[model samples]
Target: MDEIYECPQCNQKITVPSEIDRAAQLELAELVHMGRRIDAIAVIIAKYKLGLLDSKIMMAHITAQKDTCVRCGNKLLEDGVTNCASCSALNLNWQ
Candidate 1:
């Protein structure tokens, strides 16, 4: 069953799939931050046993909201390397 959550700030309803738990989200974010896109995709393929195209789509969906602080989800500076304003976490745009 899908989990429904209410956004505390916006009071909007959000539906989340059970497969993509918080820990998996964090792990994918970490892999993206390290510029290991292939590894990230491989993880999805192995976990879901999906083919290449499907796995790529899953990876894209997982990381569509990139360029944010992996630790705090703060918008990152565009300089390619900067510290997150909210949590002092390092943000690097390796692409």
Candidate 2:
């Protein structure tokens, strides 16, 4: 019998023989959770070296917004005000 699985990298469905061990799959999951791009690539390389061609791709997504008072490093609200709510500084920039 073969077990069907979804590829997290390319969203492709594949089936592998049930005889394969589960420990290798768990190890791959751990590597994906590391959250470093280079580390993820290294894991892929190592898997390939061990004759494991069917590997997963990991991606780290981070979003950062810049909206704070220049004088004070405090975050600014929706309105573009020079003074921050916490600190009264006349240097707020929002974008």
**Estimated TM-score per prediction?**
0.46, 0.28
lDDT of 1 by residue, 1-95 (tens): 64444333333343333575667667766787677889988886776455776555434433324667545677766543345667654443333
Q: Which portions of model 1 show Cα errors greater than 4 Å?
A: 1-17, 64-95
lDDT scores for all predictions? Answer: 0.55, 0.38
Alpha carbon lDDT at 90, candidate 2: 36
Cα displacement (Å) at residue 73, model 1: 14
Model 1 TM-score is 0.46
lDDT of 2 at 47: 51
| Candidate 1, residue 81: lDDT | 38
Winning model by TM-score: 1
Worst 10 residues of 1 by lDDT: 6-15
